[model samples]
Target: MPDLLVEHHGVQVLVCSADGATIATEQDALDHLVGAAFQGAELVAVPAGRFDDRFYDLSSGVAGAILQKLANYRVRLAVVGDISHHMGTGTALRDLVREANRGRDIWFVTDLNELTTRLAPRP
Candidate 1:
């Protein structure tokens, strides 16, 4: 199925439904952002599998570039699915996820419920 917009926590999110497609480059990331923009989506949800294995390698620069593009476009990004295993690959990647999760612009969540909570209002 193609990307579709869904409301979660009252936020319009464009979900990338392309299963098994590896988003390994900045262009691939940009494509999703563009699709979201076109759909007037305020946020984006992408499955963890959408990202290539290299994205976990901090030195590869894939993750940084993708996240940067999302920020540049003012689009919130949520990487959905369990990435706890990937967290053990290296300190840089683990630190990156930790830092991103601490902010509002981007997040790495284990499931859709966590994604909603992450985007929900905090008091």
Candidate 2:
């Protein structure tokens, strides 16, 4: 079974299944998110490495599944890396990611400190 890792991003940032592969099925992804999203941790980082290598490329269904799961939670997600490489490949995918990012709920940031400001507690 895969394990979840709570990392220190100057604050608590739970990273789910660091060594786990990209979710094989939609159900598996959703179930995992249910347990992974809320760790009582203030910040949650979704490392591309946690998912499939293709996550950057996002050619597989895992990408969409992950996004859908995040939306269900109505919670924000922080991606701790640069996605220019993948986004550069296709206009559609780039647009999709860019649009998704436009919403404050999803962030693709290179630094973790930025998370604190973006994910501040609602009250």
User: Which structure among the candidates has the greatest lDDT?
Assistant: 1
Relative to the true structure, candidate 1 reaches a TM of: 0.89
Per-residue CA lDDT of model 1 for 1-123, tens digit only, reads 888788877888888885646788888877756555568788888899888988888898888888888788888888888877787866898888889888888888888888877777778
TM-score of each: 0.89, 0.63
lDDT score, candidate 2 = 0.60
Q: What is the C-alpha RMSD of each candidate to the true structure, in Å?
A: 1.6, 4.5
Give one digit per residue, the lDDT tens place, for model 2 in 5-119.
4545244566654565555555655556545666564445765555555555556756677777767866456776666666767786777767866776667776556555655
